[model samples]
Target chain A: MTRKILRNVGVPILSFVLLLLVWQWVVVGFHVASYIAPRPRQAFLAVTQNWSALWPLILGTIRETVYGFFVGAALGLGLGVIMAKVPVLQRIVYPVLVLSQAVPIIALAAPLVLILGFSVTPKVVIVAWIVFFPVTVNVLDGLTHVDKDLLNLARVYGASRWRTFIHIEIPATATPLFSGLKIGATYAVTGAIIGELAASDGASLALYQEHANANLNTAAVYGTTMVMTAIGITWFLLVVGVEVFATPWQRRTVARRWRRR
Target chain B: MTLLELRDVAKTFGDTIALSPTSLAIAEGSFVAIVGPSGCGKSTMFNVIAGLLTPDGGDVLVKGERVNGTTGHVGYMLQKDLLVPWRTVEDNITMAKRLTGRVSAADREEARAVARQYGLGDFLRHYPTALSGGMRQRVAFMRTLVTHQTLLLLDEPFGALDAQTRLEMQQWLLQVWRDTGRTVLFITHDVDESIFLSDRVIVMSPRPGRVVADFANPLPRPRTVDTLIEPAFIDLKTKVMRLLHREDA
Candidate 1:
């Protein structure tokens, strides 16, 4: 277990430290001005010194992301299941859903801010919207294409539609659904930041980023970037944790062997 | 008494006929094997009997009542084991009872006992991925039999196994059939398997399949591997093969 942890947790930390060293050298050696590009230490100091101002913005972005992720994932799964079960609904709505993806999220953000009037609602909606398509597509694919022989066996045994859905459809769709969730998890944070950038009543991380960039406070920009990366990593890990527990049967033996070593 | 009777049952998919007025009856506690070449609608016949397909012409009467276009009458095992990979062997075996609200304490006990008898006691907690193809089929058979359905439609359940596993499973199946006394309608292309496991062998002709011949086995009970070398077994095997191969000619 210790060996496994060293490989997993230790290696990443080592690589990250090496990257910071390189970054520090590159900034110092090139004699880059602080206003254009800051050293790692400067960025760290910017985060620590400006903690009070950055904290609330960070907290706000996290909230919007979490709320948007749940709502979007729920809606995506529900609609995807509906589409899989009823082909007519899929036929009517599928083209429209595809078309919506073509119109960029940025284009919608301005109109959404105008309509919703600079509330958290717009931020949450934007996050949810960005994550929806992948989740829906994955879930629909999983449900429709379950193993044919297994389905026939269920039919012959007189399994009720509900039972078949529960036993066969749900489990079969889990891996694909989790794939969608992972993709959505990454997008949720970006969506919230975009909404905040478009229009916000007060300070959010995106607004902080805009101010830092406008003032050429390069360290503060990097600090905001670091905070967003943290949020994205945490969200992704949370989804992965759920996937690990939800589908124990799908665990890889190769991974288990590595853990054992 | 006849447990299952098909009366002039026919089926067509669009302009193509799948089964052509096929009729047969299965007696209670009897083992029957149906042998035919591929595309002879052998599967379609089993599907109709299992109530997976509606016959275009006549009736499928189970215990003298017509059942058409409905399922769940017989325990059906397909070519693949079809055990849900996510479920353990025990869960897969007892799934039917759970689905139908028959999962009483007694039924659970019966399922455990059956699993034990089938040599799956040690692996009850293991998922299907942990098992061999033969072992998976054993679980599938147990799953089918544990439903306590007296009629079984096994659509080439052993067709996927290796030669050695298939032979062992054939003997295991015979023992189970002897013990349970369930009426089995088995489908196979192998003439040897048909004659070895069946009391009666039914043959079907080419596409839009129809029953071409039906003959009772003259072989004795408690059959062994030695039976394969016996002249009587060879005679029966040859007869069924001739009937099947003639359709090709």
Candidate 2:
């Protein structure tokens, strides 16, 4: 078990340390100006020194991201199921959905804030807008493309529409649903930051980063960026953990395939 | 007792005739095998009886009730095990019950009992991916059996197995059929398999498929692999082969 944990956790940490060393070497050797690009240690120190001041802003951004992600995920799943059930709705809505993704979320963020006011609501709306497309598209694909044999099996046994949906459709679509959720998780962080940058009355990570940039506090800016990245990574891992819990059978299948190799 | 009757049932897809006006009567608790070449409308016939496809003409009667274009009258298995990869063996077995209505504790107990009775007790919690091909097929069979339907339509259930496993599965299937006393209509192109497992062998002609000949097996019950070489089995096989070839000519 310890060996397994080392393989999973140790390798990544070792690689991260190597990366930090490289960053340090590049900064010191080039005699880079600290104001232009802070050393990794400087960035780390900046965040730790101002941890008390920055903690609330980080928490606020996280809260907005969580709210937006859940809202978007729920809306995407519900819409995908609806579209799958009714092909006519899919025909009308799918093109619009794709086209909507073409319009940049950044373009909509300012107006969304202007209309919704400088509250968490606008930020959540922006995150939700960014997160919904992948979730809906993936879920719809999963639902529409369920194995025909399984569907026939359900029908042969006289499963009702609702029962079939519960038993066959849901299980079949779960993997794809998780795929969308993972993508949405990363996008959700970006959405929160965009919304915060557009308008936020309270302090947020984006606002903090903007202030640090204006003051030429490069170390603080780098520190804030690192925090944002950490949040994105944490959300992604959380989704992956949920996926593993939900789909135990998939893990076994994957293990079997690996053993075969 | 006639459990299922198909009278002058015909089907067409666009301009192509898939099945002719074919008629068949399946007795209660009889094991019947249908052998035919590819595209011989065996699947179309199975679909019609399973109520997945409505016959263009005539009627399909189950227990004296005309059931056409309606489903849920019989248990059906396919060449592929079609076991849901995500479900455990026990869950897969009880899937039919879960689908049709609520699965009570009694239903789960019965499923466990069936699995245990069939030597699958150890695999109740195991997913389909963990099972061997033969075991997966057994699970598929158990799933169909748990549906509690009197008639089962198995379309080449062992077609995907290796030769050795297929032989073992054939015997296993025969034992299960005898133990359950359920009427089984098995579809396969393997003439030897049709003679070995079934009480009756049905030979079907090429597309626009019609029953060329229906021969009752003279072999006794609890037949073994050695029965494949029995004179009666050979004679019946030869006759079925002749009819199939005659249709080709």
Candidate 3:
């Protein structure tokens, strides 16, 4: 099992290393303009050299995204379970939830900025809004997909509602909940970036964008984009790790797929 | 004294009446068989008696106490072995006891003991998907036993098995019934199985079912598969077929 986990982890890490090699060798070989594609070493140094400048902004984005992701996900999960179980509430409330999303998040971001004003609140709101729908839908599917035969078995056994939910519904729906969390994690990363971009004119990655544009530092612009990509990858891997721990069953399923191949 | 008695028990589904005022009395420790054509309320009669359904109007008495609205007090084995796929074989057998939170260490030990006796000792930790159909049926039967209910309700428990497995299970069931001596009300469409397993057999009409005839199996105790060829066994089946309006060789 340990070997299997290591092997799984190894593929992505190796891919990343090969990517960096291509990036470094390509820049060196092509003598690519620094503004267009800085050497891999320059991008690597960017994080450590500018730690004092970058840490605060990075932390600030993380804080907003994490906060919004959880708040929205928690609300979505609770509401989704209720909606799945109660048809009348579902009928009354579902369209509102659906309609809320059809209008794009960016379309609403401007008004949000106008009202909330260049604060952490706008970013958090973006994260929350983005994360909410996937969490709700996945959770609802998970909760509803509990087996009918199991329900009947429980009924025949005269299991109490609390016991039934704890034993049957929760375990039965574990995979779906993890799925919701993964979506929420992806949304959270996007939400943070959007929040940072929309909120302040001269701070964080967006600030780097401004400086890079004014100086015509195309490599710096690409470098900032590279940083963003790294953050996204880090956050996604974190979610996947948590999912593996939370649902070993999923890991077993993945292992089976690997075997089949 | 009757262990279970159904008085004028009827069931209706919307416009269709399934059973019409069917009454039955099963004595303590007796094995009673109910056989009828497809679509007959034979299964419904047992369902009503098992407390899975309420008669449109009537009373179900178990040990002289009314038990129609009571579910879980009677253990029922359905045609399909409804074992939870995620649960292990041992867990499947004691599922009801675990669910009700009454399955204690002693109860589980008893469940394991029963499984071991039934040739599933090796596969207790195995999942349902790993087991064969015959093995699944045995686990289902073990589940009914673990419920520890005095009245057992089985609806075609061996109906899904192949011929060989069916015969094997029928023998296993007979031994289990003989040893446990739990009052059993088994419903089936198979005529031979009805005669082979029952102390008394009740024959029913197709729809709006009623007990058209009852016969003491008259076969000797410790009956086996070979008993099907006995003169008395053939005699009993021939009589039931005549009542069923079917020609017999």
DockQ of each: 0.44, 0.56, 0.32
- Model 2 clash pairs are none
Model 3 misplaced stretches (Cα beyond 4 Å): A1-7, A10-34, A37-42, A111-122, A200-261, B234-249
Scored by TM-score, the top model is: 2
Candidate 3, residues A65-141: lDDT per residue as tens digits?
77898888888888788987897998898899899889877778889889999888888888888788888888788
For candidate 2, lDDT tens digit of each residue in A1-261? 799789988998999899889999989999999998899999999899999999998899899999999999998999899999999999999999888889888899878876999989999998888888889989999999999988988998888999999899988999999999999999899999999998877688998999999999999999999999889889988999999888888866433322210
Question: What is the clash count of model 1?
Answer: 0
> What DockQ would candidate 2 receive versus the native complex?
0.56
Report the backbone clash tally of model 3. 2
DockQ ranking of the models: 2, 1, 3
lDDT of 1 by residue, B1-249 (tens): 999999999998887788899788899999999998887889999988888788889999999988887888899997788887677777788878766655677776777899998888887777788888999999999999988889999999999999899999999999999999999999998888998999999988776678889999988988899988899998988888888787778
How good is the docking of model 1, as DockQ? 0.44
Q: Candidate 2 residues B1-249, lDDT tens each?
A: 999999999999997788999999999999999999987889999999998899999999999999999999999999998898887888888889888887788878888898999898988878889899999999999999988999999999999999999999999998899889999999999999999999899988866778888999989978987898889999999998888788778
Query: Cα deviation of B19 in candidate 2 (Å)?
Result: 1.1
- For model 2, the TM-score of its B chain against the native B chain is 0.98
Give the better candidate number (1 or 2) by DockQ.
2
Query: For model 1, what is the alpha-carbon lDDT of residue B189?
Result: 87
First chain of candidate 1, TM-score: 0.91
Place model 3 in a CAPRI quality band: acceptable
Which candidate number maximizes lDDT? 2
